[model samples]
Target: MFDKVLIANRGEIALRILRACRELGIATVAVHSTADENAMHVRLADESVCIGPPPARDSYLNIPSLLAACEITGADAVHPGYGFLAENARFAEILGEHNITFIGPSPEHIRIMGDKIEAKKTAIRLGIPVVPGSPGAVRSGDEAARIAEEIGFPVLIKAAAGGGGRGMKVARTPADLAEALTTAQTEAKAAFGDDAVYLERYLAKPRHIEVQILGDGQGNAVHLGERDCSLQRRHQKLWEEALSPALNADQRHAIGTRVATAIADLGYSGAGTIEFLYENGEFFFIEMNTRLQVEHPVTESITGIDIVQEQIRIAAGAKLSFTQDDIVFSGHAIECRINAENPLTFTPSPGHIDSVHVPGGLGVRVDSGIYAGYTVPPYYDSLIAKLIVMGKSRNECLMRLRRALGEYVIEGVETTIPLFIDLLKDDDIIDGNYDIHWLENYLERRRQ
Candidate 1:
């Protein structure tokens, strides 16, 4: 086991990683920017370091400062909670070169999975189903047109290195392909510094589904289950639930087993998520998140497995303590990402939290870093907390989620709590009959 672990991020996830490390008897080093000088995680960590000024580029994302902090604190491992450098292959390699363990997958796997083109090819090689379209990047407008024709109308042009719905466009008909292609390429270059784009058949109403897996780099892995993350706005997931209301027991087992087997075959280590788009009872591979996902708590709530702890143990050369049969899924879990933003206009609302109140009951959990006087800086993400609730059934979980959301209060700044509360009243959401486009359409209807 590592003597001390340095957390290289901020916000609620930093606190999440800190708690995991503390439970394992590992000392913690919290790295923060000037804006987070009084943050909760920094205050609770065994040691703290001010990396740089408030800007993420000069601070949380600064590799040299992180290395210096590790060296100064004598930390042996680093835990990248979710964003920032979590999926950066070079960051993982540099830490490895400096003889510090990165509590994640190998750099090789990260590199391969980071590229959409290579990841699709790898998924196909592993017998995973993928949306049929261009086998590689489409270099010309004419080539994109050709592929779009073959794939049928309404194809999606996606950036090879894109995420969060950026650098993506959809051509609903042959006449729209040229503009869509050019705009996607332009956005791709600007957002990711890569003009490489690919085409795929766009399903009209697909649901976003992802499988969570853990590996020990010793040819051993297990799948906890899947999450239905179809709710989103501008490609950002707001609501997530485990034991998706869309899949049956047989379907769940089939997909989970396949994902676990595939990860084990690739010798993947630590925590990873294989995301897919599902429609008409078919699953198509979209991409793979090479690091832990923002919605990991829902998986943990259902499986009763500490994913972060497993990540540390794997990095420390521990074999998986359990096998596929030993794993069991229970009940249903739901997580609402409560962001510090205007509920109506969806604008960032960062400021001092005057008074904060979190609800607690059986199977309800709140992961947050803000206190009464904590000033939420404008330089970071607006996600203030995660509210998770579990129940013996999906219906019970939904009711619990409603009660929990009603009780969660963060004053002196607006939040998205009202949006979630309104959502729970809708028949579509209650019946779990929503697709990926449901939330956008719902919001549009509200605007009307």
Candidate 2:
């Protein structure tokens, strides 16, 4: 086991990793931007290093700063707890060159899965089901239009190398496709430095489901089941629940196994998530998240697994403790992503947090990077905390989550709390009858 691991992230995820390291008897070093000095992750870590100023490019996303921090702190490994450089293939290679473990998959895996076109090609080659659309990246709007005509109208134009909603546009008509293509290309170029964009048949309504997998380096892998993340805004996942109340066991096992086997055969290791779109009993591969997910706690709550700890062990060349047979899923788990944004306008709200009171209970877990008196800076992601609750049934879990949300009091900044509170009361959410567009329409309906 590594004596020390540097967390190349901030906020609740940083704290989450630090806490896991502590439990594993490993020392931790936290790298934060100047704006995050008062962050809870910094306070709880064994040691802290300031990478740079607030802008993510200079701090959290600064490759050199992160590597320097690792070297300066003598960290044996780096745990990129999602986002930033988590899926950057070059970063993984740099860590390998420095003889430091990158607690994720191999650089090659990240590269193959990082690019949308490449990911789709790989999936198709592996006989994995994929949504019908362009065969590869479209160089121009004309190309995108041609592909859209072939696939049918109402297609989605997406960046070939980005995720989390960036560089995605839906063209409902040929006229819209032309403009959307240009905008998508520009956005993709700015965000990923790659102007290449792709097209896909836009599903009118689908359930966003993802499978969790743990792969040991010895060519062994197991699926931890699925997560229902259909509750989203624009493309950001606002909430996630385990066991995908939408998919039956047969469908879950089939899709999960296929995704795991395909990726595992490609030499994937550590913890990763394979995201899929479920529509009309058919599952389609979308993309794979190559690092720890923000909603990992929900997976943990149901399986009694410490994902961060497992990531550490896996990085240290340890074999998986449990196999597919040993794994057991118990109860239901739900996660609400509490962002620093207006519940109504859905705009980012960043400022000082005057006060904070976290919820606690038997199955309630709050992963946060902010505390009372800590400022929610406007420089980064607006996410403040992830409220996770577990129970024997989805109904009980909903009650727990509702109570937990009520108990959480974050002052001095607008939040999506009211949004979740309202969502909880919706019959569609309560009945588990929702799609990716459900929240969008629901919010619209709420306004009118």
Candidate 3:
């Protein structure tokens, strides 16, 4: 086990990793920007270092600064808690070269899975179902149009290196294909510094389901069920639930097993998620997140597994603590990503938190880094906390989540609490009758 681990991120996830390290008897080093000087993680870590200014390019995203902090703290391993450089292949390689451990998958694995085109091809080679589209990246709008015609209308043009819905466009007909291709390529180039884009057949009203898996990098892996992350806005997941209300035991087991086996066979280590779009009782591979996901708590709640600890252990050459048979899925779990934003307008709300009240009760967990006096800097993501709740069934879980959201309070800033409160009462959300596009449509309706 590593004696000390450097957390290369901030906010709630940084604190989440710190708590995990403390439990495992590992000292933690927190690296923060100037804006996050009063951050909870910085206050709680055994030691803290100022990386750079508030700008992410000079701070959180600066590789040299992170390396310097690791060197100064004598950190034996680095744990990137979801974002920044979590899935950066070069970052992992640099750590390996420095003889420092990276608590994630191998650089080769990250590289392969990070590229959407390569990931889809790998999935297809492994016999995992994938959406029909171009065999590879289309070089021009003409090529995209040809592929769209062959695959039928309603194709999605997605960036090969994109995420968070930034570099994506949809074309429902041939006339729209050229514009979609141009827009996707331009956005992809701007967001990822790569102009490469690929086409995929878009499925209407598909439910987004992802399977979580852990591997030992030597062909041993196990699946811990799946999480339903269909509740999204602008491609960002707003809510997630485990033991998806959409899948039965047989369907879950089959998909989970296939994903686990394929990842293990590819020598994947630590934690990873295989995302799929499900519609009409069939699953189509969307992409693979080679690092821990933001919505991992829901999976942990149902599986009784400490995914962060498992990542560290795997990096330290430990085999999985349990086999697939030893794993058991229990009750349903739901997680609401509380963002500091206007509940109705969805604009970023960054200000001092005057007073706050976190809900507490059985099966309710709150993971946050904000305090009463802390100011939410506008330099990063708006997520401030994660409220996870578990219950014996989906209905019970929703009821518990609703109660917990009502009990929660944050002053001096707008939050999505109101949005969640309203959503909990909606018939579609309560009945779990939603898809990837459902939330966006609902929000549009509200605007109208």
Candidate 4:
């Protein structure tokens, strides 16, 4: 293992990576923006360095300063947790040029998978089912309209390089396609610096299921099964659970094995997630995230595997200790993202956290960085903590989660606790009979 690794992000994930390094006896350097001078992750890390000011472009996303911090701290490796520079190919390439290890996949894998359209093509070539619509990126509204008519009424205009629901628009009729295409392209350019857009057959009510894979640099790889991230509002996942309530045993196994083999063929390494859209009974590949996902705790909760440790070991060229057979997924696990935002408006509510009360007991795990006095910064992501709960069955897990969420108390700044509490109250969510639009509709009705 490396003597020390620099974590290039902030919030709960930074603390998550820090705990992993500590368990592996690896020292960690936490990098922070000037706004986060006294953040929990910084104080918890073995060492810390401030890269820039409050703004992300000047600070957290500042590649030069991040590399400089690693160089000055003499960190042997750097772990970009999920967002920020995690999927940046140039970032990984720079680390390689500096002789410092990047605790993720190679730049080639990141580049291919990071591009939405390219990943769809790769999935299509691999015989993986993809939403059939666009052959590739389309140039004009006229092209988008022709494709939409062929694909049927409802179609989605998606950015060729989009994620986190940034550059997407859905059109139900031919007239809407032209306007939606223009809007998607504009948003794509603003968000990703690329105006390219593609088309896809939009499944009105589909479940977002993702397969988590762990692979050594060599050809050895294994899938940790699937997580049901169907609960989302505006394409952002709100809650995630393992062993999707939608899939049967056969569907799960088929998707798992296929994703494992395909990525292994690509020579991918470390921890990565292969996301698919499942509607009715059919599954279609969406894209692949070439880094650890924020919702990874649910997979780890049930598998009895420390994914961060596994990711680190793989980065160090250490063989994965568990095989496909050894990967026995037990029980059910659920994660509720607790963010510094208003439940009613779903807007960012960044301020000081007056007090924090966490629940405890067997099977109840809370991954958080904020405490009583931490000032929630408005410049970064709204996520403050992640509450993960596991049980022997889905029903039991839901019940435990309900209890745990009730016990979770964050005083002062507004949080999504009320929203999550309302979510738990819904019979659809509790019974897992909901889709991506379930939460949004539910919230809408409640507001009305």
Best by lDDT: 1
lDDT of 1 by residue, 1-448 (tens): 9999999999999999999999999999999999999999999999999999999999988999999999999999999989899999999999999999999999999999999999999999988889998999998989998889899989999999878888899999989999999999999999999999999999999999999999999999999999999999988999999989999999999988888999999999999999999999999999999888989999999988999999999999999988989878999999999998987678999998999999999999999999999999999889999999999999999999999988888999999999999999999999999999999999998989
What local lDDT does model 3 show for residue 324?
96
lDDT of 2 by residue, 1-448 (tens): 9989999988889889999999899999989888988888888889999999989999998988888998899999999998888998999999999999999988988899888899989888877899999998889767777788999989998999898788999999998988898899899999889889889999999999998988986888888889999988788899999988987778877887787787667767899988889899988889988899988888999889898899899989998888888888899999999999999888999998899999998889988878778888898888899999999999999999999999999999999999999888889899999999988888888789
* Candidate 2 displacement at residue 201 in angstroms: 1.1
The residue ranges of model 1 lying beyond 4 angstroms of the native Cα positions read: none
What is the Cα-based TM-score of model 4?
Answer: 0.98
Model 3 lDDT on a 0 to 1 scale: 0.93
- Output the lDDT of residue 263, model 4: 76
TM-score of each model, paired residue for residue: 0.99, 0.97, 0.99, 0.98
| Clashes, model 1 | 0
Could you tell me how far off, in angstroms, the CA of residue 86 lies in candidate 2 after the best superposition? Answer: 0.5
Worst 10 residues of 3 by lDDT: 139-148
- Residue-by-residue lDDT tens digits, candidate 3, 1-448: 9999999999999999999999999999999999999999999999999999999999998999999999999999999989899999999999999989999999998999999999999999888999999888898877887888889889999999979897899999888888888888999999999989999999988999999999998879999999999999988999999989999999998999898889888888999999999999999998999888888899899989999999999999998889999988999999999999998789999999999999999999999999899999999999999999999999999999999999999999999999999999899998889999999999999999
- Give model 2's TM-score versus the native structure: 0.97
CA lDDT of 88 in candidate 4?
A: 92
Better of 1 and 2 by TM-score: 1
Q: Choose 3 or 4, whichever is better by lDDT.
A: 3
Q: What is the per-residue lDDT of model 4 for residues 210-275, given as tens digits with 9 covering 90 to 100?
A: 999988979889999899998888889889999899988898898899988887787889999989
